[model samples]
Each structure stands twice: as C-alpha cells, then as structure tokens.
Target: INHQTWYIKAEWRGIDLVPRMLELFEGHHEYPVTEKVRIDVLRRFGYYSTESNGHLSEYVAWYRKRPEEIARWIDTGSWINGETGGYLRVCTEGRNWFETEFPQWLAEAPKSFAASERSGEHGSYIIEGLETGRIYRGHFNVINGSTITNLPPDAVVEVPGYVDRNGLNIPRVGDLPLGCAAVCNQSISVQRLAVHAAVTGDDRLLRQAFLMDPLVGAVCTPPEIWQMVDEMLVAGEAWLPQYADAIAAAKARLAQGKAIPTRTGYAGAARLHTKTIDEMRADRVNSQRNAEATDKAKLRPAAAKKAG
Candidate 1:
C-alpha cells in the first residue's frame, strides 16, 4: 500500500485486546494504561494534519467531554517511568514530544535495522510443531470475524493463535465483555463501510463511514460530516482513481456553495509544536537515540532520571 494508506494502520489499532489479554493472564486489570495509550495516540496522530486533518480535533474534544469517565479510568499503579507493563512518558505526558521529535529525527538521520538480530519492539506470535507438536502460546494478529463471534464476520481481528505445519490456527474467543464487544462493533461498522466504499467508489457509503465514526459523529454535525467527507475525497483525489466520477461530483458540490463555518487553524487540544533540528542538536544523544530506536516510545532511563 502507498504511504497515503499507511496512516490507517497507524490510527485504527485503538483499544485493542490488551485489556482482554490482561484479564485472561493476570485475572484482573484496569483500563488506565489502555486509556492513556488511546489518548496519547489521538494526540500523537492528531498532530499530523496532513494525515488526520480536522478529525484529530474531534477526538480530543470527545475525550475532553468525558473528563469524569477518563479520570475514573486512571489507576496510579499502572503508571511507569522506565519500565515495561506500565505507562511511560511517551504513553502519557511526553506523548507530544515523542510524536513530534521522533519523526523529525527519522527523516534527518535515517538508521538501518538490516544488520540487527533483535530490536526493542516485536510482535507476539506463537510458532508450533517445528520439531515436536509443541504449541508455544502467544497472540497473533489475524482476520478474526468468525473467531471473535461477536464482531462482524468480515472484520479483521487479532486473537491468540498457534502456527503449526498446517499453518496458523485461530480459536474462538467466544464473546468479549459486552462493553468491549460493543465498542469493537461500532468501529467495525465504520471499517466495513469504508472497505465497501473504497472497493466500489460509492461516495455515499464513504460519507456514511465518516458519519458512523465514533469521534467524528460525536463532534461533527451531519452537514459538517458531509462537507468534511467531500473535502477529504477531493484532497485525496490524486490517489483515488476509483473515485473518479465521485470526485467530479464532489468537486461540483464543493464549488456550488459556501462551506459551513469551521475552525480553520485549530490545533488539537493536546498538540505540541514539533522540535526544530537546532533544538534537537542541543540534546544530541537523545535525538540520536530517538533516530535509531525502532520503538519510538521505548522507555529512556536517562531521560526519566532527568525528569525525576
């Protein structure tokens, strides 16, 4: 897929099975860390105006609207500085710094991982039956509409699986907690509509997808959602050959009327200015580390010590 489409993966993995995994493995879990990750992701991804445009602001607004609920989700013990299994700076207060500075470091000082045997980040998957019929237990990201049992059959899902000579086998999770399933289903609805819209170039369905999106729907009026979809399609028209006829129609509609009033230059609520190269140079070691690190949010002991 093109770089234009990479943001889908970057943005869509919200409120995943980490909570469920915690419940299964550890017997109980709170959602503070998960909630922090969600909020930080919104702030981080929202800062990319080229990727998210105005949608980031909508997400921030939605979170802000539910301050009491979000506060309730917070668990102090789940917080961390330089440790795994908890919230680090990048997962919390320093999210903007990581989001803003890390990309700049990557673009300016590219690092090659080709020679590395191990990296700070890796996905969890189980390999089975290489020598014996041993089933190493871990989670695998796979298409899971049927396995999940609660979500739509067409939805992509991540579930626990094992890879054997027969290839990967996914087991039914039975049902997620009702609230979790409900949340997943809502997002899946938008995703399903989006896939159909992209394949068929049905602009109406595309608009419906945007309308059905949780944050967008919560924050934007119907007229605003309609107009936003039109603008997004027109802005992305070059990469959307399937939407040729739809693009023309959108162009005509956009041309015929004055747009609804919107905050033209509104930065997201939690946005931070990207660090300049000169400013980064002042902290050369940190900048260099950021440049080389595959996990941009990996805990930094020195930085954490300084912060303390």
Candidate 2:
C-alpha cells in the first residue's frame, strides 16, 4: 500500500528499495514496521548513523535540519555519508565512501578564511585560510591537517573570511607573526614552475637545474624533489630535455670509472704518519738511557775510592 502511494509512478531501477522491503517483510508480526525495514530504507537513500568516533557531528546536524540542502553539498563535494548527505555508494569488498570529490568542490568554493602569512623552516612562507585555506595549503602539499600551530607564532597572520572581486579580503585581515613572511617575497617563477612540474608529472627541468648546480636541490624539500622526479618519469618524453644535463653527468661519471665524489675530503690521504714519528722517539730514548748508565758507573767508582 505504501509503495502504491509513494513509488507507483517511480521507474524501477537496479536496486529498488520499497519493493524489496515489501517482499522481505511480508509475514512478520512487525511486518513493514521493523528496525530492519528502517535500516533498509535509510540505506537505499544513502543515509547511515554517524559513528561515535567520527568528528562529523556538525555536518550531520546541518544535514538533519536541512535534508534538501544535501544536493548543494554533494555538488560541492563537501557532503559525507553518516555525517552529511550525498555520498557515492560503491560496494566492492567493503562498503566505503571515498572523499575524492571534496577537492573538486574546494577548487571552486569561496575562500572562507586566511591565516597570517608564516615562514616555513627553510625560508618558505605558509599562508593559510581558516575554512577553505586547507585546500590551497594541501594543494601545494605544504602543511598537514587543519591547525597551523606548526607555523611560527611571531609571523604576521591574516585570515579574511570572504574576498572581493579584486581578490582582496572582506571582513577582517589580521596579522600573523613576522616569521610567516619568509617565503612571502619568494619568486613566483620558482613556485609556479615547481607546481607545473608536479601537475604535469615532469621532473626533467628540476633535475637539470639540480645537476647544473647542486644548490638548486637544497632550495626545495627532498620529498618535493622526489615527487617531481616521479611525475617527470610518468610524463616520459616531456621530461627528457630537463633531465638531459643530469643524465649526461651521470654517464660521464660512469665512463671515467670514478664514483660520485663525497662531500668529505679524499679517503686515501688519511694514512698513518705516526709510525715514523714513534720509531724516531724510541731511538732517542735508548740513547738517553745509555748516557745515564755511563754516568752512574763513573760515580760508583769514585765513591769506592773515597771509602778505601
């Protein structure tokens, strides 16, 4: 009767919930009014109880108050099942919903907050936003999680919740500690080129730069360099030109039968000069002992003559 009222006009799909529930609950005392029935209904609509351990209660509360708003949330990729609405139901070995869609939504989402610019460990600046700031920070593969406590407290901070057309902050722009400004004046060319290399999976340019001058490698993090290399290899031919210098240098070293030189001084020069010095000292000591014995023999004869 309920199906006739609610789903009579609805087209049958691969997994129809109402019909399945009706068939499954045909003869029980509770009939269509069981916990299983409720679970089944919620499952079909992509709803689930939030786990006690998850930190999505805020989103869950929002979802409960405005169920219809789920469409917008899902479109923005901010929605999560069990916490928020609109999650893809992918049933493989286990039932899990991936957060793959969130980044896409974040890319288009408005800036929610901004942190005061802070300096990174190696003269790098970290500018974060409060709500949407994590997106940009994560995109650059900078900091982890939400909090920016890892940043220096002395850096000047700024986090305007909203922004205007000129890309200026709306609301309030606060100052972070001065330490946050280390990378603020860094060349965009380096940052952009690095980002482009990563997105395109090209490391050839980075490798060439590093090879031509080893100091270039010191400017970026080790992980960043590895990531660029991985991407370049993945991109194949596009990275060859960039890596040409490094490759040539490697081949040259191989041909000369010389390993890459260590930063430390040469190993062979550290031989023992102590052997020659020790022998000379031993001869001097023996000569001193003989001279002392001759002087004592003369003294003993003079003492015997005085006694006689």
Candidate 3:
C-alpha cells in the first residue's frame, strides 16, 4: 500500500515526503487509501510507508500523538487496519489457547499424520525451484550491498531476485526514490540498535533504541522514555534476565519517588480494550476473520480517483 501510495503521491507531491505531504491534512477529500497512517507518513517524509497501519504506526513518530488525535486513527473496522497491540494480543491468546486446549483436543484428533498442501508461503517453493532448476522470481529481504545505492550496505532491503540451480541471485535495481531510501534508513537504524542491544545486553543501547523509535520519541521526552524503559524492565523481569542490574537501578529510582512526568491513563493512539470471549462470540465470524487474517482488508477498489 505504501509503495504504491508513495509512487502515486510522490509523482506529484514533491521529492521530500516531509513538509510537502502536510498539504494533505488541511482539507477533506475522498482519498482512496484505506490506511491513513501511510498518507501521514508521505506527508511527513515525502515517501511511502509499509506494513499494516496498526504495526507500522508504532515504528514512526507521527500519527500516534495526543489522546484526541489518537481517537481519529483508531478504527474498529478490523484489527490490522489499526488496532493497538493487535498482533501481540492475537498471538498471545492463540498460544495460551493451544497450551490449555490442544492436548485435550488431541485425544479426539486423527490418528494418522497426513501431509497438508502448502498454503501461500513460498519457502518450500523456493527450495523446490533451487533443487529442480526451475526459475522463480520473488521479493526477498537481503543484506543491502549495492541493490539500493542510497541505503546502508548492511541494511536488509526488500527487492526482487531470481532463484534456480545457481541459487538466489540479486539483480541490480539501482536506487529507490530519495525519499523512500531516507524512510527505510530510519528503520534500519532502529533495527541495528535492537539487534546490538539483544546481543550485548547493553542497557544504555537498549535505552537508545527506545529513543530512536518513531512513536516513542514523538510522544515522550527523554526522562519519560527512561522511566518507561524502567517500568517495562520491572514489569517484564521474568523474561528479561539480561536487564537485572538495569531493573534494579530502575526500582531504586522509583523508590526515591522522583519519577518523570507521563501522560497518565494514556493507552496510546489506537489502543482497544481487549474483548472478552463473550464479546468476541457476539460477532464470531467477523471477529474470527479479523483475528486470523493476514490481510485485514480484502476489498477491491472499484476505481480510485481524486475526489472533486
């Protein structure tokens, strides 16, 4: 959506997606895109954005602002359209249900282990093409060398590639639009910071990574971000053994009663209260569809024209 949105928008919006895209906000129009965040991104950075708006909005500094503005972005049409913490809530519930009920269900399950056909995933198809010497073209996330001249060499870039007996080969695609590369570069910085923080257990680096996050930085001051990290570490202590010392320090700080100011009761821009099982069952079909779907929306636009 962002790629196509950027191509069309950038063709006319100017090379930089930042200030130029802002022109879109002042007026009301029947814009064609379903994800509003992408439009906000183009207006801010002069490039297209990616991922569903729900997850994608978390990675940027805009859109998820004050509580009032947040209400505008929150849509209950479906989870992926822009539900807060949608992926985490869904996956966690799935795992919990599996652990609690799968064993019981297994007692009545089929005795034979029958192979099921592959669905839409391409991992097996790629392997088959390599072994059988059949040609395959697919978009891949690979370490960027020169495929995109503007981005960092180490950044993972998604681009077109070919597969066969010779193994995967990347074709030189030259450069993305200047604005596109800039937007991607920002994400690469965050990715690198996260990877390094995990490998080294560097609390300082972890804190830096939070500061680099688009939404985190946009909505928080340095002190608030620091306090938030401490809060998260203490809350997640069971899973964060590496942050033992950091958590201890955070606890000490809180104990001193000198905590930074924060937006009390702020759930975030598009957060939703978790639905109970009874609430979920009320609209079972649609709820199940939204929860399980990879793509939240499956609508085909009849025609996308600039509204007069």
Decoy 1 TM-score against native: 0.61
Candidate 1 global CA lDDT score: 0.53
lDDT at 232 for candidate 1? 89
lDDT of each: 0.53, 0.31, 0.66
Q: Using lDDT as the measure, what is the rank order of every candidate, best first?
A: 3, 1, 2
Which candidate achieves the best lDDT against the true structure? 3
For model 1, the stretches where C-alpha displacement exceeds 4 angstroms are: 1-117, 120-135, 164-166, 300-308
Q: Could you tell me which residue pairs clash in candidate 3? A: 16-46, 17-45, 17-46, 18-44, 18-45, 18-46, 21-43, 60-214, 60-215, 61-214
Which of the two, 1 or 2, has more TM-score?
A: 1
**TM-score to true structure, per model:** 0.61, 0.20, 0.75
Clashes of 2: 24
**Model 3 TM-score, 2 decimals:** 0.75
The clash count for each model shown is 0, 24, 10
Q: Highest TM-score among the candidates is held by which one?
A: 3
lDDT for each residue of candidate 3 in 1-308, tens digit (9 for 90 to 100): 12222332333445554444446543435322445775566565665555655556666666676656764554545556566776566655444444544565568857553347444556876987799998888877788799777778877777778889888999887777776666667777877887898777788999998998777888788989889888998899999888788889989988898887666886655655665556656766655555445544553222234579
Q: Which scores better on lDDT, 1 or 3?
A: 3
